[model samples]
Target: MRAQRVEDTPGGRLPAVADPLRPFESRSAGVATTERVLFGRLTTEDPVQAVVRRIRTAIGLGILTDGQKLPKEADLARQLGVTAFSLREALSALRDAGLIVTRVGKNGGSYVQRPPASDSIAEEQLTGLTATELRDLGDWRAVLVTYAAWLAAQRASAASSDRLASYAEELADADTAAAARRALGRFHVELAAAAQSMRLTRAELALHEEFDWLVQVLLRDETHRRAIVRTMLEVSATVRAGDAAAAWVAGEQLTAYLVTELTRSRLRLIAAGSAGPGPKRRRAGDIVAELRRISKQTVGILEDIADDVAAGVTMPPTSGELNGVVARSVLPRLGRVEDLVHGVGFMAEVGLLPEAEYWMEWWQRASDGTFDRDYSHQLDPSLDDFYEYGSQDYLTRPRATGRPNAMGPYIDHGGVDDYLVTVSLPVAREGTFLGVICIDIRVAGLERALSPWLARADGTCLVLNAESRVLLSNAVRYNVGDVLPQSSDLSLTDVGWFGWVVARAPEEP
Candidate 1:
């Protein structure tokens, strides 16, 4: 204990007991403080392991990219709130772990590196994970990246989007696991960066701590790398195109693909024999691809219609001139949409055409938000349509969020009179909510293709639409149309962009 400087009697003169927990002395350059929350403020965990984990995670995630110089020993320890000795210990451990290289002299410090993904290393990291853990990781990552893409669509400048595109190309061209790993992590961080949210970028960095290195193990395979690059490009395209709704959809699909890859990579390590093509995920992907075609199609049509509005058309007032505008500008495209486009109904608001059911297309026998189909997708691009497009759960959701959506598996009793799922992608031009372009797929058709998969699992299995309504089920305990029951035992696996696989927990043996 150091000598106390007491100012008064009765022990008041004693130097206040130095609080061990007293905030560390601030330096000329203060610690960049994300602290216990966003940035890791290690507490309760072993100091050496925590430092190792944090650095490994940073390097893996590309937050500290390859060859990036780390701060000097004293500064790093101060920033991490660890002792100088502990920081040195962690650095030595990292060197042995192949995550960093160190030098011992003046102008020498730790430099970040990405370790090779050997089967041994990957299994060591993965062995402790349960299937549930894998699923949850994918879900949370999905939420972050998807929301980021949507905001990026609205906020990113052209140069930023082009940069994302360039990054995607580099990922596709990567010939090594380390290169791919860095690109993949960098893409997510840059996407968050494009969203322009420092908090989001930091959150993404936090996620990398647990997942980045593990994901690198999967990136080693060229097939997985190519697959991810394709999805990244898709995401970049939508963001570049400035279609917020479409960007969000593409983001979810990308995450679903990542989730599938992570599962397959896990299987390759553990089951040995079970690793092969994931037919269910592939089928779900095909279905999603079929449904999502409309976003680009709809956006194109909206742009064309906007051009018409821009080119030399006089704003007709009250002289049936507005009727003429609808005829010359709107009816043709709405009456006959692209081959891939279809609709179950058309609902419009008057500012658009005064509740006009501008008939174009709807019956896409296939699929969509089990889709952000933009519930979107839509009423023949009419909302401003018949009394049909009400401000309800399905019709109004896209308009409000300005994002694509999928809703239903409920009976369209008053209309189609059969159970259906509606995929809608919203249409907006110049920030005006025009309406949605939607397709109606019969839930029965989905049930047939999905039944066997749902049945393969031992316990209760269900196929759910965007909203937790059961679309298909293997057990009678819960029938179609019932909202899925909440239970900690239930684990929901996303089946592409359109639906989820709700699995019943295994019973105690």
Candidate 2:
């Protein structure tokens, strides 16, 4: 009302206007652009919560951290591929939730803020767990899992139900105790994930997260591992037979089994001079002993394979015989494969190999869309039958003898795609060293075990033969019969009743 006077028009009137909704302003660093779709179905009821849930998950994974600055509006908008207006709306909502705080000034930026610690305590309380609450969470887990099993029995698709039965068969056929335990644990997790209850699924996943620390402590007690497996199998059978009530009863029984064994575990830890074994204890020594045992057993399996292969027995090729197999001989035919290579002044975007023995005949496609053909077989090395020997000098040498080197993936080769694993058997003839029997497993139903690790943003795992041909992989473009890392120190062993050596790809030099 006390403002300066305005100039009057011919009619002595002032202009009028409507107010506009301006976007929020915040001082934050820029973020990378990426589109993110929410998990499950996107519905109208909780779209904001859905977005919030994904962001929270990223935070949990350390993708976003406390006090880390957020992206600027323009960058954030670009990264999310959403309009700045939409991004601002989302940020405003987050600010109200206290997940972010804005700052002003040349050096100032928005940062992820921490909530009060009281929220953590409330979550713990809602979980109904505490140090004094119970020494074992198994009792509650037993009830939940048993209920889940019953529901799975009722609602699981026929294929899923059949898969459960098949896993049980595998459990029965497990050559080692370790395999049995792994298979057993896998069955439990899969069953829970397949269950109809989201709560059960989440609880099961939480159980695995908890197991990371607890497994070492618990596995020292063989009885505990055995009891869990036995109980799981029992419950699995009841569920498979469609007896929900019986499955529940079996689940309770499994919990009891765990309870007794956990008591023993507690006793052992107590006798070891503390309520829980830790830095001062002999845990490290025990781990070394276990590793030694595994090595010994793995060597034994290699020896057996070596004997069979050396004798010219019908041992399967590491990735199977691709060249000679007739279409009638197998259910599925060979598929296309792509190669990835790094060369001088160039890196690979994608590569394809022609059916040729000489490296000079092969072609290289560069990331920048350039292609070159080089055919010096000497430089190429055999695309197949290469072993990965550890780094030595200027050249990575291949194994001189036929004997399979002792470190590689555990592939169950020669089986149907639905039942595959990498397996290497050491080979020797008349006590003379030959080569190893190598097999590339087609891991049919166990995609879950492989997919999670293989689908990671970085790193990859693969199974190849002594010739360095690709047999199977968790990542990267691979097809059956593709040439792979030829130099491997891959072998087989039966260290324990259950033993496996997982192969990790070498880092770029």
Candidate 3:
């Protein structure tokens, strides 16, 4: 007997297929003759891999539905800007992977296969990964999702926001686990698309292809599915409200929860001896020693700048004129010492200067030269309070009654919206505190300094303040100013002036 020809429908059933040649012929001849260029040429060195990625992505995204026939070989090759040989190789690989199927004779063509349950596929993939790998994957996704949500909040139109909200609602209303998982994936991809960057969207799609199976697995538990849906709703609401920072936080929280779930599963697997051993965890003491060295180096630079300001540059008790001179002479010196220093200035006691206003000199990396602002006039209350007495009282208060203060992750500084950390050394002569010599450093700069050490580890490293707000993090999941949860997995060490370094190995055995 001849084999029964089968095709998968959206409803997940194989139907008795008519001649595939009939569908091709019934469609306009132009349909076969013409080609639709969905994306640009493959730039990767391995053209076959690139071709495979594009087709797999399309299938994952539902751009090519199950059983949908691909274009003719020649036309597809032309559209993808690859030779027929390369395209065939990619197709063969995809077929081997069960992503596509092929038939023979006049009706022969490549058709997308009905993908397996995402959770089942994801569980299979997870079996081969070590604990550390899973954690790293989770951290990577968190960063991408956070950034995508932040950008989306900044650039999304009202209509786009509405669509995101609608997707969230759809997820909440999903009647089955399978339906909910699909809705959840769509919402995330749509969120990335709203960022208005095609590159980011493509990156997000790649992540989905790898991680969607995990998400599907998670959604199998009714309670977990509900919780995830709630988090998605929160993200949508934050993005729709146009709060970029809040949206980022929401995205991070969602990813963190997902990571926690995956970690628990990994631990269970480890106990079962299903997974092999992972890399050795780095000693916390080693990380602390390295951070101490970096902190001392930073403090040494600040102290030298302070000495120059206190000696050569004089701040006359009542004359604002000397403020300019102090800035001109000292700000340039501060800039010379460190390229990462964002700004340097002196804040005088109120009414000590001629203008009865505090003097401030600020320099941004983007700015050509130092500019002046009113330290007491236009500064945010949180910052103004910090410089005046908050620094000595809050940050430096613990070390010595009187010493330098490092205050950070402050928003609304230098007339721009950026997170900053300031190191202030009280400049005093003869028991009189002349003013505080303050240096501003972008939090991003600090992260770059610690990135090398972080890269050596198998988990995330966060530099956080005493209050648990982040100062710098290797995992972009937590931004400056976001509060971190206290967990037993986190190895917390005090870095003195900088704050505590919280290292958490996601793959900890």
Candidate 2 lowest-lDDT run of ten: 343-352
Query: For residues 1-509, could you state the per-residue lDDT of candidate 2 as single tens digits?
Result: 22111122222111111100001122111111000221222334544544454444333322344665665656555544555666567667778978778888974555667454232232233223211112335556566667777787676554445445545555556554434433444455556644655556545544532331233344334555555556666776776777778877887786566443443333233233222433433343332233344334434544543343344423322112222221111112111111111111100011111332211112333457343433322323454633221231101111243332332223323212122333333333354322333223233222222232333313344444443444334432333244554465433322232233334554435
Cα-based TM-score, every candidate: 0.45, 0.29, 0.47
Predicted candidate 1 versus true structure: per-residue lDDT over 158-247, tens digit per residue: 766766676678777877666666667767777887787767876776676566556777777777777788888888999999999999
Q: Which candidate leads the pack in TM-score?
A: 3
User: Where does model 2 exceed 4 Å of error?
Assistant: 1-136, 165-185, 211-216, 220-223, 275-509
Better of 2 and 3 by lDDT: 3
* Residue 104 lDDT, candidate 3, scale 0-100: 88
**Cα RMSD for candidates in order:** 22.6, 25.1, 15.2
lDDT per model vs. reference: 0.58, 0.39, 0.62
Q: Of the pair 1 and 3, which is ahead by lDDT?
A: 3
lDDT of 2 at 389: 19
For residue 405, model 2's alpha carbon misses the true position, in angstroms, by 70
